[model samples]
Target: MAPRPRFSSVPHHALAALRQRPAVATAVFATGLLAATAVVNRQLARKAERENPPMGRFIHVHGVRLHYVERGEGRPLVLLHGNGTMIQDLQSSNLIDLAAERFRVIAFDRPGFGHSARPRGRIWGPNEQADLFKEALDKMDIDRTVVLGHSWAASIAAAMALRHRASVEALVLASGYYFPTYRPDLAAPSIPAIPVLGDVISNTISPILARLMWPGLMRKLFGPKPVPEKFAAFPVEMALRPSQLHASAEEAAMMVPMAVAASKTYSEITVPTVILAGEDDRLIDVEQSVRLHRVIRNSRLRRIAGAGHMIQQTEAAILMAAIDEAASISAGGGSDPRDVMTTNG
Candidate 1:
């Protein structure tokens, strides 16, 4: 009773079995590698075009494919949308419809966000994305132009101005995010390597956490503080569609560091610039734009009341006014933000 059952002796064969488990070890290692590889591929597949603007063709640059719309023939005005949304969101925005009349409004899907392909193993932060745009413009023979960056695009615009100051004529940063401190609410999408186990889980299930706690995620980015019916007429649903999910996820992941890096260069910005923000912006703090306005020498800040993060979506008229104001102010024609610039008039 005290002795109980004696323990069985360790088997040499069991030790041998453990040593011979290379197949099992290889399988396990392969599983992890495969998981990582699939994720890498989805990130790589960013080059595939899912949503094409009914207007523009796809351009390939350094293994990346970008979707952009080139409308009008005057001075080039390149438009960049924020994270999660692409050129379509900007196209849906009045910012485009309003600005295209006077300037050549060219809007593009940043790599990993829109119809453009995603390049893996690298951060497509503002610097890289900005560099990509300069290359694209060079390819298009656009030596000088205006660049308007919205949301995260603002980071890219800042980078563009910093890197190639002379190439860009004027910079209009709307709801820009080149702040040093990241908001606490920012969430990163952990994209998986495959359809179900990887991207599916990331694109679908986990967002439920946000949808449940903060239903605002389900809404459109602009306000009256709720999702706009026109933008999110359908829900966020699934982000798997390449144009929506991967690009947005990468942008989200890259936000904080990119913003911090770009913030340092503001005071150095020499371009005639304008900082546009919503007084009630929920996505990024208004101070970000305000500070940017204060730091840049020639930059001015325009804050629209009762507007949310989607200033372009919510306060399009005001944003257009600001853009026209920037152009007028730079040209020494008008100091007022409301100066009209209609070619017909």
Candidate 2:
């Protein structure tokens, strides 16, 4: 008191108050951390966009903006990439270029992936996406074409064929989940799809966590075979943006339920179907393809050796061949001897 420690006495009182109100202190610290994380995420998202600009054109349809890459000239082939990827995924696989040589390839970002806009207030299940894509294709004057869906998009492809039978001539389903299966891994990612909580997590923590986990995930996806160098060109940061992360989370949340709903209608698919599966797919069982092939009477199953979930990257040639097979089979070829093409792993 005699020393007149004015500043020291004030700080001691403030520290005592903060210690007394630990809950408030925790809330304050959390708020600051979240604010900082949000700022960093925004900067990173902007940088990603600047580094990886859109490689295709945009089309506004049904109150949504869709991004797509068009190439070559021949029978129309519409590519629907799986969850967490965009047109670049197909392009990176070289399937787009290979198919472009023989078919008019149109690869889309599908609702929320890449540069596409995904409007909220609606559940974008397989049927919903199928409806949107159907309207979009119609707007572009694509009355009928071969539709290829990889992984989760496989359900969308099936929905398109089921809903618009006349429009979807054939289907190429790769690494697809046709039936409901136990997927505990989806739990963590699905958290970002929750309403208020999802918004906060996607904007703050998901992107950061994804950066750390990307490599291991890629390895698992392309396991049993080394990941191709070309896949490194994929803009991982772009996919890590908050909006895309939310979209991916939503898709993960919808995967099982969508499969449950879609499986009931698979046997009704009369279009020429080609089921492509990686024999050594670590993520999904190849038996999924086998079951799908059995269900779809007009389907052909091609199991690749030494391949994984990313058959597009590991077996692009085989994918191209499958596309050709879909096109050929769709052209009214009566019977085929090789309904099931299996190569030993």
Candidate 3:
């Protein structure tokens, strides 16, 4: 009892000292908070992977491992997902099945997203990713097929067409950001891409923040239309993993710059292209697709009314029609304007 009374007094004395040295106390609190955050995030990532295991095959190309889903049987069609997501994004949208009906669909989990390896020490802009996928497709013996890119991946599709003009037979760009514009909101999420600070943030607070903001982000992405029930199959936890958070942040940081760099070569893309977008896309303006259609001379444009940025999920029927039109055009077949649905170009 006497010893306990002495220890109690010691704690009081230590508390008084810590209160006097506010800086030390603050540092201690910060350290504790970070430790807790790390523990929680680590557990969450493990749980996410456990619950949602990889459902596709893997290929090693140029020292990178890519996870991809291969389905259907016809001309090869490559599906490239947008920022922050994996192949499952397209799979959940039913786009894979729909396209697989007429084409051999191959949807890739782009570098750093999903189960793919995103090696550090090099920048992975749209062009770099395009080259990687080109090699991977070559290894898979895919020579030419229509390439569909949604959101950020649209840039990658364009880069692929420009770099290997003969490989991409056609292009279906949907809700893509093709030009640089003022995007102040990107500043916050991009913090996790900043070297040491980025590592710490991505491993801790970034995932937490992403989880909190996911609903609103989904709402915006599929706005003017409710987020489809099918999208529930998308593993939000997987996207919230620390690794994906870093990849997403990096993409966000490079979005504007990549757009500016890629925009210069848009005119050189001679592939048959079709641009699709929701008339009321809340995440990226529908005008982006309209403008891209205007730039690509051999492009068809379809602006779906009452749709949003996640047209892949909400407008899979319309998108499938677009893919069919693209494939037909790639084969030198012409589009029947009556079958063109809602063409503006």
Candidate 4:
């Protein structure tokens, strides 16, 4: 073997040229992104890390066991995440802490996210998941409370409002997709749908898939601008675990159909609702969130400038103010555009 001589550093112009070839640069960047989160997220668990403001704790309820962390127990508020992310989506998000101060913020892994058990032989959809959540609330002795959902959970929150309206108080939907359709090619787990095949593959190459997929998306999300080193790693590391992919796949399977079905049902909602979205969110289109705001009467729309789909993390302060405004209206106070950015003060 021959040892090659190394240069001191590549020139700045050379680096710029490499970046110009986006596909090459992005793929390399993605390779690094996936690996970093697993490292930092491991450290996050140390010191018995408290969940944002109210601290995280779990409970057992409904047919399936649930894992949730509750903080500041006054009004029961549930945080549901989008697909491809877990309760960590909220924990790793700015929304968790913002709500913990005023409302009893409860965030959990929906059925298949985080450490929750995936029910056998059940079709996991927004409606079914919402029903299970209502039972969890009942088991926790929470009769009526606001439901906050993001992306996929937005549909679930709507289901709760429409089906179990008596049990729901108000609604907050952020970066939502109202279920009328979904991207099918990507949602299904690469190797899980078969009978004998799922069993064989689950035992075999699943770990590898989790490892590679986690980092790649992180890189893409942060492409134009780099995401903070620490934040990017935690969510992916938490997502690529065992039951995580299985649950993500299941919900994704039912996602498109349920979304299509739910879109038709959106006009049925009569709850006091608040919709917040990033004017620049690249994941779910901003128009979808806007459409939702227009359709649901007694609903308010908030648009944050330059923020992406993960507004809770990217524009934490702004997102909090929007929530505060939502709370004010729900509490019977006069809400105006003036209240929109008031939290900045």
Candidate 5:
């Protein structure tokens, strides 16, 4: 009678109902997690935007808004940065300023990489990006310019040269990844970038994970040579913002396929081409540039000694020299007779 007094209010049927509906508890937990993650993501995004506002102008091309910065005036020299970066990467190295001194420098944030927007349902391959930028250039009345691309962007520059041969007068590819090379680590982000679940993951855990891993990744990217203090000072959190993280992951996921397809057309690029690689390039083997140089009939390959993959940052002088040379060749100055330089260690 004493025990019944305390338990009389609780019904056996109510306890049975709670035990039968565990899924409801799970759903509530999941929804709460997603809601919390969304809130945090928004706060982080706002902070990033406030700290790193757009440093360039925006133009609409092919139904997508693209961000770009233009400086100086002369022959138009277009700069395209690689994965996980924006126009700042080139600007940080002063490549834009240096090239602007002699050429009209136009540095673009490839679709989704910076302030640019990637339209839904777009695959955004190198060819697609090349065509989109070409259209943008057309709208600006800019044509037949030297296009410089670093890392993954090298493929885009090559695609531009091949697909819009008349518009791209020359190409300077730095730390480029050519040929189909399988990289297992690329799959980590790739999986999370797929459709519905990817959207959730990218907005939730991906940005946080990316921020944590970025420091280590930077070290690897500049191995055998230290990352310059200036480059390290870049607003990295901007790149880790949810939208950019998703975009970069998507691009990285598609890289292998893009390279496989683009490799077939390397020999077809007829524009004056300059391939620059660091002798100690840890991200991409210098041999890729060598092979690329071999295939592109009008290419010259230069290997910078003691430089890592980020030649644009660590070896601006060398990169500027290559850009200048490419600009010269594009203006009918002709290629340096030497097809390849001995590796400098």
Candidate 6:
């Protein structure tokens, strides 16, 4: 008989077994891909950190280190950024510098968003974040300051106003997401931020997918208006790092439930409130700001025309004016007549 052909030094039995159990082959391939992805992700993360170092100082609050940047020297003004951002979001837009010229501007990276730490096994909703920030401000001897929160931070500002009323003199809520609205898109990250496997996915494939999706999502966020020129230079890669991505997912997941609970307590905020919304805000409805203005008895609402969700960057002049009005009202001075302009889109 002719010599039998040997299969590339492999046993026919093993080859047949692999073919019989296709799932085993798939699992092996998936494991290799995951390992490779993890190695590449680690290298990229290290490179990003080396390129973009921390831009602020750190202070320990309840044994958790918080990062913040302060400027100017006048009435205290605390700036809290939205989800997926750091203090640089305010700094790059020159909001901190502009406010700093007249007020002691303190901009913070809310726990887990930047260099700040979010301890494991902790659920940090708006209330939890408010309490943590309150402790940090207390350590810094900061009290009775105007708190400005953009987007998701808006809810945190409201929580601070409600829980720590004595410390929050005024609130400037820009592009605030109030009144729990069903947003299926926003709910995407909620599942992946759970425990165990969720943690694994967030640290692995989540950041990778986020990095890939950022460009399109950012375009939508600044739609009907161009993204600020300075934003091009923002360290987005660093924000997309694994830890930050996980924190962002957690925050996004918690937003709706937190807003639902906090919306009921809007009337409790007695501080002078300034609700700002861009007429073209595509992220959160501008009507939310209108509702907020109605609920907070002392609120002044400003609807900016031709502006997008990022009013702090797009309509800085108007936003700054609103901040000034809020500060004045908090100081027992009446609201600015210019601030009560009619809503126009």
Q: Global lDDT of each model?
A: 0.69, 0.90, 0.89, 0.68, 0.86, 0.84
Q: Give the TM-score of candidate 5.
A: 0.91
lDDT of 4 by residue, 1-345 (tens): 899998757677667877899888888776566456444434442222333222345566656877787777577788887776766666666578778888887787777666566777877788888988888888788888888887778888999999998887778888887746457554446445455555444433454566776666654443323465447435454465545655666665665677778888787787677788776666667788778876787677777666667766666666666566566666674443322221111
Q: After superposition, how far is residue 83 of candidate 5 from its true place, in Å?
A: 0.6
Largest TM-score belongs to which candidate? 2
Q: Look at candidate 6 and give me any clashing residue pairs.
A: none
Overall local distance difference test of candidate 2? 0.90
Show where candidate 3 strays beyond 4 Å: 1-17, 333-345
For model 1, state the Cα shift of residue 286 in Å.
0.8
Model 6 misplacement above 4 A: 1-17, 333-345
Candidate 5 segments exceeding 4 Å error: 1-27, 342-345
Output the better candidate (2/3) by TM-score: 2
Write down the RMSD of all candidates, one decimal each: 9.1, 2.7, 2.9, 12.1, 3.9, 3.6
TM-score for each predicted model, relative to the true structure: 0.74, 0.94, 0.93, 0.74, 0.91, 0.92
- Per-residue lDDT over 1-345 for candidate 2, one digit per residue giving the tens place of the 0 to 100 score: 378554557878877888999998898889999999999999999898899888989889889999999999988999999999988899988999999999999999988789999999988999999999998889889889999999999999999999999998888999998888999999999999999999999999999999999989999999988888999878888899999999999999998898888889999998988899999999889999999998998889999888899998888888888888888877865535438888543
lDDT of 4 at 243: 50
TM-score of 3: 0.93
Whole-structure CA lDDT of model 4: 0.68
User: Of the pair 3 and 4, which is ahead by lDDT?
Assistant: 3
- What is the per-residue lDDT of model 6 for residues 35-143, given as tens digits with 9 covering 90 to 100? 7877787788778878978887999988788999989999999999999888888888889888988999989988887778888778888998999999989988987
What's the residue-level lDDT of 133 in candidate 1? 90
lDDT (Cα) of model 1: 0.69
Q: 201, model 4: CA deviation in Å?
A: 4.0
